[model samples]
Structures are given as C-alpha cells and as structure tokens.
Target: MPRTREPFWRRLLAGTLPLLVWSLHFAFAYGLAAAQCTPAGMRPGGPDRALLGAVTLAAIGACAWLAWRAREVPRREDAGLLDWARLVLAVLALVAVAWTGVPLLLVTGCA
Candidate 1:
C-alpha cells in the first residue's frame, strides 16, 4: 500500500507545536510583564494590556489547533508505538499550553 503524506507544516512541527506555541506565549506574557515591572521597561504607563491579551488569545488558538490536529490522527489497534507517541505528545503539549495560560486569566498586568 502507498504511504500517506502529511502536510509540509504538519511534518515540520508535527507533535511538538503546542509546546512551541506555549513557549512563545510564556515569553510574551511573563516576559512582557516582567519588563514592564521594571522602571526603565516603560515610561510608567504600564505594560501593554492589549498586546498581552492578543498574545494570550493567539497562544490558546494555536494550542487548540494542535489538539484538534492530534485528534484527527487515526486510532487503529494496529498502529505502532511511534504513531501513539505523536498523539500523546500533542495531547501533552496542549496540557502544557493550558497550564501555562491559566495565569493570564488571573494576572493581567505588571501590578
């Protein structure tokens, strides 16, 4: 039988996209707040709330997409360990994204 081909982007990140996006979210969320907390980080107005909000939404969207893609993978009894690994990794990545995002709801600023 002929082997099925995954999309180029899918093949590039595949099972690790959620974690990658989460890393980006973390950098933007905490990193931005931390920067704003500093005296020189800004002119004293405060961290950019709008910017952070946008970042949070984008991160969540990416993680949700990753999880959706993971669920699209077929679950066959005959599937091998590698196939299983991809699904599990994607799920784990989504979990990581969620855990990292909870703070966004409760903490929204440098204060």
Candidate 2:
C-alpha cells in the first residue's frame, strides 16, 4: 500500500511543540540558576522560580495536548510508531514538568 502523508499543520505542530517545550524548560532552568548566581541575591530555591517552572511546564503540556488533538484530525495515516512515540514523549514530558515543576515552584516561591 502507498504511504499516507500528514497535513502541513500536523507535521508542523508535531515538530515544533516538543522543541518549544524543551527550549523553554532549559531556558528557565538556566535562567533561574544564572539569576541566582548574579549579585542580585535572586536564587533558584525560591517560590517565584518554582512557580515559573510549573507554569512553563503546564503551558508545554497544554500545547502538546493541542498538538495531539490536531493530529487526530483528517491528517495522513502515514504516522508511524516513531510519530506516536514522539507524541507519547511529549505527554510524558508534560507530566514530568508538572511533577518537578510544582515542587520547584512551591519551594522557590515562584508560585
């Protein structure tokens, strides 16, 4: 049988969301560390930093869900195991964000 093709948007979302999430995650992590290390006494072990992390993760999760639902539309059936794996990873990542994010936020006073 011929291979199916995914729509442009579906492919775009699938490719972009994870990257966006990861970048945000890393940026926040590093940002907090740097901010804390600066002369400003701003530390990562505060509530505000933790809140930022949690919020960032939540946003990532929401975006991933949106992407997943979008993929369910009339997109091409060419989606393979890898495609599904990526989506699953996105979800798992979101969960990780929540798990680690909440505590971080609470401790950091970012909440």
Candidate 1 ranges with C-alpha deviation above 4 Å: 1-12, 42-46, 108-111
Give the Cα error of residue 42 in candidate 1, in Å: 4.3
Please, what is the whole-model Cα lDDT of each candidate in the order they appear?
Answer: 0.67, 0.60
Per-model C-alpha RMSD: 3.8, 5.6
Cα lDDT of model 2 by residue, 1-111, tens digit: 765586767766665576567567756765765566565655455435645765675666675675576465335586765566556656666665555455455553332
In angstroms, how far off is 35's CA in candidate 2? 0.6
TM-score of every candidate relative to the true structure: 0.66, 0.53
Total backbone collisions for each predicted model: 0, 11
TM-score of decoy 1: 0.66
Per-residue lDDT for 1-111 in model 1, tens only? 766676646555665565677787888777877787787776355667677767777777776776676674576766555456567766775676667656654664455
Residue 34 in model 2: shift from native, Å? 3.7
Ten consecutive residues with minimal summed lDDT in candidate 2?
102-111
Candidate 2 has a TM-score of: 0.53
